[model samples]
Target chain A: MPAALQATLEFLRAYAGPLIASLVIVAVLPLIAGYVVLVERKVMADMQARLGPMRVGPHGLLQPIADAVKLLLKEDIIPEKADFWIFWLAPLVSVTAAMLSMAALAFGPAFQIARDINVGILFVVGISSLGIFGIVLGGWASNSHYSLIGALRSAAQLVSYETAAGMALVSGLLLGGSLQIRTIVEEQARQGVWFIFLAPVAFFIYMVASIAETNRAPFDLPEAESELVAGYMTEYSGFRWSLYFLAEYANMIVVASVATTLFLGGWMRPFASVRWMGWVDFLPPLLALGVAGYCVYRAPRQPVPVQKLVMLGVAGLCALVALLLAVPLLLPAAFFLKAGIHGAFWFVAKVGAYIFVFMWLRFTLPRYRFDQLMRLGWYFLIPVSIVNVMALGVGLVLHWQYRVNLWLALGGTTLLTLLIALWLVWADRKREAEALQARGGPGTPAADSYAG
Target chain B: MLDKVIFYVFGGIAVVSAALVVTRRNAVHSAVFLITALLATAGIFLQLRAEFLFVVQIILYVGGIMVLFVFVIMLVNLDVALQQIQFSRQKWVALLVTLALAGQVGAMLWWAGQPGKKTLPLPVSVAAPAEKLPANAEAVAHSLFGPYLLPFEIASLLLLVAMIGAVVMAKKKV
Candidate 1:
C-alpha cells in the first residue's frame, strides 16, 4: 500500500473493534427496544387485567417482529403543505441523536463499545437533548396546529425537566468524584454501597425527570392523544413513525442505563464487596435457569404442537444462555470471560428493573395536565434537586475539611433533604387546599383531589 | 489530510447554514438554519478537543437557546411577517450591525491564522495530547467552584434578575 493508504488502513485496524461494537449496538438496540415495547404492552395488560397480543406467537413473543413488518410495509406520507425534506429528516434526526448518545455509555466494564470519553455523562446528556430538535422540527414541518403545539410543549417540558435531571446527576457525580461512567460504578464498588442509598432524593428526582424527558405518561403532554392527537408525531407514518418509536425506547434505555450506571452501580452484584455475598456472582445463570424452567413448565400447557415447539425452543435458548453464563463461572482462570459475562448480566438486569419501573409508573399514574406537569418539574423537582445538590456539596465539604466519614456525611445530607422534602410536601398540600377552598366544590374543574 | 477535510466540511456547513439563517424567507426555516449552524460550531468545538465547550455549546446553545428561538418562531404570526417587505424599516441598522459583526469575525480569523500561531489538526486528536491544558470537566469545575466562583455567582444573579424582569414585564397585574 502507499504510505498514506497504509496509515489509513492501520488506523482502521486499530479502531475496527470499537467500530464493529458500535455497529452491533446500533443494530441490537432497536430490536431490544422493540421487545421492550412488547414487554411494556404485556406488563400494562397484566396490570389492566387483560390478555395482550397473545395470538401473534406463543404469548406474543413475535409481536414486535409483526409490528416491525407492518410499520415497514405501511405507506410513508407527507402532507401537501408539509416541508417534505424536513419531514423525511425528522425521524432520522431523532433516531440518530438517541443512538449517538449511547456512544458515551459504558454498558459494563467489559461490554462498553466506545472508548470511555472523559466527559461521558455530559456527552450523553448533550446528544440526547438534541433529539428535541427532531420533535420541534417534525412538528413545525408538519404544518399543523396540533403538531406545532405539541412540539412547543415538548420543547418546554424537556428544557424544564433537564434542569432537575442534570442537578440529580450532579449529586451522583459528587459522590463518584468523576464524570466517567465506569469510574462512577467503580466508586460504588469501592464504597460497598450504591449511590442510591446515599442520594435517594437525587435518584428520585432523576427517575421523575427521566420519565418527563422521555415524554412518558403523567408528563407526556406533548403526545396527549386526548389533547394533542399524537402530538409531534401527528403527521408521521410507516417506517418514519417507527424510527421515532425506536428513538423513544432507545432514549428510555439510555436513561435507564445512566440511572443504573450512576445510582445503582453499573454492573456490580448487590453487596459486591462482601465475602459471603460472592455467590451473588452466580445469580445471572440461576436467573437464566429459572427462566428456562418457567418456559419448560409452560411448554406442555400450550394448546397446539406448534406453540409447544416454539415454547420448547424458547426454553432451549434460555438454557443455552444459562449454560453460557455458567461457563464463565467455571473458568476461574479466564478473568476476561468471567468479568464480561457477569458484568453484562448484572448491568442488563439493573436496566431491566429500571425499565419495569418505567412501565409500572406509566400504567399506574394518570396523565398530568400541562400546567401541572410544569409545576411539578419547576416548583417541586427543580427546587428539591437544587437543595439536594447544595446539601450534598456541603456534606462533601464537611467530610473533606473535618475528616468526617463519607457515609456519615452522606447520611446527614440525606436526612436534611428528607426534612426539606417533608416541608415542601406540606407547603404544596396547604396551597392546594387553599386553592380548592377558593374554588368551592369537590367536582369543580381543577379541584385539588388530595385536599378533600 | 483527514483533519483538513473534516475542518473544511464542518466549517463549510457552519458558514452555509449561518448564511441560510439570515437569508431564509420563513422565520421557522431561519431558526432551523440557526440550529444547524450552532450544531456545526459545536462539531468544530469537538474537533478542537474542547470537549467541555462542545458539550456546553450543544446543551446550552443548540438544545436550550435554539429551542426557545424555535418556540418564538412558532408562536409569532409568521404568515404576516412573510407577507411584509423582506427589508423593512431597519435595513440600514441591520446592515450596519452585520458589517460590524463581519469585521469582528475577520479580525478573529486573521489573528487565528497568523504564521506564528499553530493551527491544531482536527481529526487525529480524539485523544487530545494537550495534557498541560486544563481541558476536562474537572478543570472546568475547579475553575467555576474555586477562583472564578465569585464571577459565577454574579453571572447567576444576573440571570435571576433577567428572569424576574421578564416575569414582571409579562404580568399584567404587576
Candidate 2:
C-alpha cells in the first residue's frame, strides 16, 4: 500500500472500536431522542390525567415513528427575507454539535466510544456549548423579531447558568480527582461512595443548572411559546424543526450522562462494594422482564389486529432483550459480557431516571420569566455554586494538609454551604420584600412583577 | 504524518477564516468567521496535544468571548452599519501601516531562518510519548497551583477588580 494509505488503514484499525461505537451512537441518537419525546408526552399526559397520542399505535407506542415520517414529508419553508444559507445550516450545526459531544461520553465500562480522553468532560462541555451557535444563528437568520430576541435570551441564559454548572462540576471533579469520565467512574467505585454523597449541594446545583443548560422547563424561556411563539424555532418547519427538537433531547441525554458519570457513579450497580448487594446485578434483567410482562398484558387489549400484532412484537422484543441480559448471569465465566451488559443497563437506567426528573419538573413547574430565570441563575445558583466550590476546596485542603478526618471535613463543609445558601435565600427574599414595600403596597404593581 | 496533516488542515482553515473575518462586509458574517477562526485555532491546539489549551480556547474564547461579539453584532442594527463606509478615509495611512507591519514580520522571519541565529522559544516539539507525559490539564493544574500560584492569584484579583468596575459602570447613578 502507499504510505499515506497504509497510515490511514492503520489509524482506522487502531480506532475501530471507538469508530464503530461512535457510528452506532450517532445513528441511534435521533431514534432514541424520538422515544424520549414519547416518554415525555406519556409522562405529561399522566400528570394531566389524559391519554397522550393513543391514536397512533397501541398506547402510542408507534407515535414517534409516525411523527418522524410526518416531519420528513411536511413542506419545508424559508421566509422571504430570511438569510437563506444560515437558515438552512442552523439545524445541521445544532444537531452536529450535540452529537459531537457524545464522543466524550463514556457510555459504560465496555461501551465507551472514545476511551481515556483526558479532557473528556471539557470536550463534552465545549462541543455542547457550540450547539448554542445553532440556536442563535437559527434565530438571527430567520429575520424575525421573536427569533432574534429568543436567540439573544438563550445566549444570555446559557452563559449565566454555565458558570454555576462549571462550578458544580468542579466539586465533582475534586471528589473524583480527575476529569476523564472513566477515571471518575472508577474513583467512585474504588471509594465505595458516589460523589453525590460527598457533595450533595454541588449535585443539587448541577441538577438545577443542567436543567437550565439543556433549556428544560422553568428555564426554557428561550422557547417559551406563550412569549416568543416557539422562540428560536418559530421560522423552522418540518425536518428542520425536528432537527432542533432532536438537538434539545440529545443535549438532555448528554447532560444526564455527565451527571450520571460524575455524581451517580457511572455504570456501577448500587451498593457495588457490598457483598450483600450482589443481587442488585439481577435488577436489569428483572426490569426488562417486567417491561415484557407489561407489554404482554397490554397486547390483548389493542382494538385493531395490526395494533395487537405490533404490541405482541414489542413484548417479544422486550423478552428477547431480557433473555440476553439474563444470559450473562447464567454463564458466570463470561465476565466481559456480564460487565458490559450490566454496566450499560445501570448507566442507561440512571440516565433515564435523570431524564424522568426533567420531565417531572417540566410538568410540575410553571415557566420562569426571563428576568426571574436570570436572577435564579446569577444571584442564586452562581453564588451558591461558588461557595460550594470554596467549601469543597477547604475540605480537601483540611483533609490533606491538616489531617482532618475526611468525612468530618466534608460534613462540616456541606453544613457551611447549607448555611450560606439559607442566608442567601433569606437575604434575597428580604430584598424583594423591601422593594415591594418601597413600591407602596401589596396590590400596587412593582416594576418586576413576574405574574402572568 | 497524520498529525502533520491535521496541523496543516487546521492551520489553513485558521488562516482563511481569519482573513474572512477581517474582509467580511456584514458584521454578523465577520463574527461568524471570527468564530470559525477561533475553532480552527482550537483544532491546532488539539493537534499540538495541548488539550488544556484546546478546551480553554473553545470554552473561554469561542464559547464566551465570541458569543459576546455575536450579541454586540445583533444588538447594533446591522443595516445602518452596512450602509456606512467600512474602511476609513485614511485608507492610504492604513495601507502604509499594513505594509510596515508585514515588513516587520518578514524581517523577523528572515532573521530567524538564519543558520547561526537562535530561534524563537517555541513550545517543545512533540517528542515525548503520549502516555509517558502527564495529561495537559493535569500539568497545567499542577503548574498553576504550584509555581505559578502567585501570578494566577494576581490575575484573578485583576479579574475581580474588572468585574466590580463593570458592575459599577452598568448601574444607574453608580
Candidate 3:
C-alpha cells in the first residue's frame, strides 16, 4: 500500500470503534425514531380507547417499517416560490443537530460515542438547541403564512423555555459539580441518591421545559394541527418530512437521555450505591424474563397462525436478551460484563420511562395556546426554576457549611421553593384578574378569543 | 495529521461561510450563512480543546442570538428590503479601515512569530496536548468566578442593563 493509504488505515484502526458506532447510530436511529413514533401512536391509542395501526402487523409492531417505506416512496414536493436551497437543507440540519448531540451521550458505562468530552452534557444541550434553526429555516424557506407563523412560534418558544431548562440543569449540575455526563452519574452514585430526590423542583422544571423544548404537547403550539396545518412542516413532503420527523423523535430521545443522566442517574440502577439494595442488580434480567413471559402468554391469543409465530419470535428475542443479561451474573469470569450490560439496561429503562411520561402528557392534556404557552414558560417555569436553583444552592451550602443532614437540608429548601411557587401562582392569578378587569371582564368576546 | 486536517477544514469553512454571510442577497440567507460561520468557528474551538467555549459559541451565539436574528428577519418584509440598495457608498472608507485593522493584526502575528524576541507577553500555549491541560470547563469557571469574578459580574450587569433597555424600548408606555 501507498504511505497515504497506510496512514489512512492506521487512523481508521485507531478510531474504528467510534466509526462503527457512528455508522450504527446513523443507520439505526431512523428506525428507532420510527418505532418511537409507533410507540407514541400506540400510547395515544391506548389513552383514547382505540387500536392504532393494527393492520400493519401484529399489534402494530411493524407499523414503523411500513410507515418508513411509505414515506420513502412518497412524492417529494417543493413549492414553486420556495427558497430551494434552504428548503433542501433544513431537514438535514435538524437531523444532523439531533444526531450530533447524541454523540456525547453515554448510553452505558462502556458506550459513549464522543468518549466523555469535558463539556458532554453542555454539548448535548447546545447542539440540540441548534435544531431550532431547522424549524426556523424550513418555515421561512417555504414562503407560506402557516409555516412562517409556526417557525416564529417555535423560535420564540424554544428561546423562552431554554433559559428555564438551562437553569434547571444548572441546579442538577450544582449537585453533580461537573459538566461531564459520566462525572454527573458518578456523583449521583457517590452520593447514594439520584438528584431527583435532592432537587425535585429542578427535575419538574426540566421536565416541563424539555417538553416545551421538544415542542411536544401541551406546549406544541408551533405545530398545532387545528390551526397551523402541520406548521413549519406544511411545505415538506415524502422523505424530507420523514427527516424532520426523525429529528423530532431524536431530539425527544436526547432530552430524555439528558434528564436520565443528570437527574435519574445515568446507567445506574436505583439505590445503586446502597449495599442493602444489591438485589436491584438482578431486576434487569428478571424484567427481561417477565417481558418474555408476557410475550409467550399472548402468543397463542393472536388471531392468525402467522401472528402467533411472529409473537413467538418476539418472545424468543426477549428470552435471548434475558439470557444475555443473566449470563454475567451467573458466571464469575464474566463479571466485568455485568456493569456495562446492567447499566445500559437501567439507562434505557429510565429514558423509556421519561419518554413514556412525555407521551402520556401528550395524550392526557390539551395543547396550550401560544401566548399561554409563552406565559407558562417565561412567567411560571423560568421564575420557579431560578428560585429552585437558588434554594438548592442554599441547601447545598447548609449541607456543606453547617454540616446539616443532606436530605433535611434539601427537603427544607424544597418546601421553601414550593411556598414561593404557590405565592407566584397566586400573584399571577391576581394579575390575570386585574388584566381581565381592564379588558372589560372575561365575558367579552375578545377575552374569549384565541387571538394567540 | 487528523487534528491539522480538522483545523484546516473548519477554518476554511469559517472563512468561506463568513464571506457568504456578507455576499448573500437575501437577509435570511445571510443569517443562515452567519450561523454556518458561527458553527464552523465553534468546530475550530473544539479542535483547540476549548470545549466550554465551543459549546458557549453554539448555545449563546448561534442558538440564542441567531434565533433572534432569524426571527426578526422573518418578521420583516424581506421583499421590500431586497429591492433596496444592498450596499452603501462607503467602499473606499471601508477598504481603508479593513486594511488598517489587517495591518495591525499582521504586525502582531509577525511580532509573535519572531524567535528570541519578546515584543509581547504570551499566554500559555492553547495547543498543548490534552493530557497536559486542566479540564477546560473547570478552568474557565474558576477564572470567571475566582480572580475575574468582578469583571464577570460587571459583564453580567452590563447584559442586564442592555436587556432592560431593550424592554424599555419595546414597551408601549414605559
Candidate 4:
C-alpha cells in the first residue's frame, strides 16, 4: 500500500473499536431496520390477512435485500430541466443526516460506542431536522410542480412536528435527570422502574411525535402514492430513489433507538431474579448454572454465540441499566447479568415493538388529507406535547411523587383536553353554519372526533 | 504531496468559478458558478484536515442553500432573458468599483506583510497530508455550551427569526 493508504489503515486499526463499531452499526442497522419495514408490512398484511414479500427470502426475511437490488438495478432517469448536480447532492445530504443521527444511540449499559457526550439527545434532534432540508431542496431543485408541493408539505409537516418532538424529549430529560443515554438508563435501573411508567403522558406524546417525525403512517401524506406521485421523490428514480429510502428506514431505526434508550430501561429485563438481589428466592439460581454449562461441558458456542456476534458487531451500545449488588459490582458474574438484561434482546424487543406499531399504523390507517395533516400537527400535537412538557416541569418543581403524580396529571390533562376539544368543536360548528348561510351553500361536514 | 495536488485543483476551480460568478452574463449561470465555488471551497477545507467543516460546508452551503438559489433563479425564468440585450448604464462605475476593491485588498496584504515575516504558512506546509480528520462533535458542543453559549443561543434565535422572516416575506398576507 502507499504511505497514505498505510496511514489511513493504521488509524482505522488503532481505533478499531469505534471505527469498526460505526461501520457495523451503519451496515447492519439498515438490514435490521428493514426488518422494521418488513414487520410493518407483515403486520399490516397479516392484519388484512395478506402475505407480504413471501417469495423473497425464507419467510420474506430477505425482502429488504431484494427490494434494494430492484431499486439499484432500475434505470436512473433525470428530467431535462433538472439541475444535475443538486439532484445528485440532495439525496446524499438526506442519507448522511439520517445516518449521523444514530451516532449517539446507546444500546445497552457499558456497551456504548462513544460514551463521553453529555448532550446526545440535543445532538440527535438537531441532526434530525437537517434531514428535512434534503426533501425540501430536492423538490425545489427538480423544477417540477409535483415535487415542489411535496417538498413544501414535508417542510411544513417536519417544522410543526419538531416542536412537539422537542417538548416530548425535554420532558424525558427533565424526568430522567441526564441527557446522556446510559446515565438515564442507569438511573432508571437503580430506581427499579422505567420512564414509560412515570412519564406515560410524555411516552404517548413521544410516540405520536416520533411517528410524525419519521413520516410514517397517516402522516405520510407528503409521499402519498396516489397524489403527489411519490412526493419530493416524484422526480427521482433508481439508485437516487434508493438513497431516500435508506434515509427513511435509517431514520425509523434512529427513533426506535431513541425511544428504547429513553422510555425503556434500556436493556433491563422486566423480571430480574430476586435471589440475584439476595433478598428473595422464587426462581432457582439457574443463571449461574446456565452460564457455566453454556460456557463449558456443552456447546460453548450455543447461547453466547448468538449474543456475542451481535455484541461484537454493535460494540459501542449504551450500557445496559445495571443492577448494582451491594458487593462485587465489578465481579464478572454481576457484570454479565447486567449486560445480559440490558443487551441486544431488550433493545431489539423494544425497538421492534415500536417498529411494529409503525407498520400497524401504515396498514390500518388511511393517509390524512393534506390540510387535515397540517392542522393536526400544528394544533393537536403541538399543544399536547407542550402541556405534557409543562406538566413534567410542574411535577419536577413541586417535588410531587412523580410516579403517581404523573399518571394523575396525565389523567387530568386528558380530561381538560377533552373539554377544550368539545368547546372548539361547538364553536367551529357555529362558524360553519354562519358561513354556509352567508355563502347560500350547505356547511362542510362536521369535524371528526380527532380533527383539530 | 496529494493534499497539495488536491488543494491546487480545488483552488484553481474556486478562482475560475469565482470569476465566472461575477462575469457570467446569465443570472442562472452566475448562480451555477457560485455553487461550483462553494463546492471547491469545501474541497479545500477537506484538504486542510477539517472534515466536519468540509461535510457541513457541502451539505449546508452547496446542497441546501445553493440549491435554493438555483431553484429561485430557475423559477424567475432567467433562461428566457438570454436572448434579450441587457446593458447596465453604470458599467464604468462598476469597473471603477472593482478596481478600487482590488486595490484595497492589495493594500491590506501589503500592510499585513510589512513586518517582513510571513504569517500564513506556504501552501505545502499548510497541508501536510490528506486523511480523515478527527471529528469531535461533543468537544464542539462543549465549547459552544461553556464559552460560546450566548452566541450559540443568539445564532439559533437569529435562525428562527430568519425562518419566520422568509415565511412572512413569501406570504400573500400577514
* Candidate with maximal DockQ: 3
The candidate that achieves the highest lDDT relative to the unseen native structure: 3
Q: Fill in the DockQ of model 2.
A: 0.66
Off by over 4 Å in 3: A1-7, A442-452, B117-127
| Cα error, candidate 1, residue B85 (Å) | 3.1
Candidate 4 Cα outliers beyond 4 Å, as residue runs: A1-10, A271-342, A400-452, B1-174
C-alpha RMSD over true interface residues, model 4: 6.5
Q: Give the Cα error of residue A284 in candidate 3, in Å.
A: 2.0
Query: Candidate 2: deviation at residue A338, Å?
Result: 1.5
Alpha-carbon lDDT, every model: 0.88, 0.90, 0.91, 0.69
| TM-score winner, 1 or 2 | 2
Q: For candidate 1, what is the DockQ-based docking class?
A: medium
Q: Estimate, for each residue in A1-452, the C-alpha lDDT of model 4 and write its tens digit.
A: 58768666766676678766679777886676566667777777789889866655434656888877788799999889987767877898788878777777777664566555555666566566567767766886788888988887776677677677777778778778776777788877776778887677677778887888777778887787888888899999999988888889888878877888888777766644333653322112333333334434333332446444443322222111111221123465555554534355567667878877787777778888877776666666677677667766765654564455555665565455556546655765676589777765544445334457
The TM-score leader among the candidates is 3
The 10-residue segment with the lowest total lDDT in model 3 chain A: A442-451
Tens digit per residue, CA lDDT, model 2, A240-318: 9999999999999999999999999999989999999899878778888999999999888889999999998998999
Please report how far candidate 3 places residue A206 from its true position, in Å.
Answer: 0.5
Candidate 2 vs candidate 4: which has greater DockQ? 2
Candidate 4 chain A lowest-lDDT run of ten? A318-327
Off by over 4 Å in 2: A1-7, A443-452, B89-125
After superposing candidate 1 on the true structure, give the runs of residues whose Cα lies further than 4 Å from its correct spot: A1-11, A436-452, B88-135, B143-154, B172-174
User: For residues A266-332, could you state the per-residue lDDT of candidate 1 as single tens digits?
Assistant: 9888888999988887878888899999999999998878999999999999999999889878876
Question: Interface RMSD of candidate 3?
Answer: 1.2
Estimated TM-score for each candidate: 0.91, 0.94, 0.95, 0.66
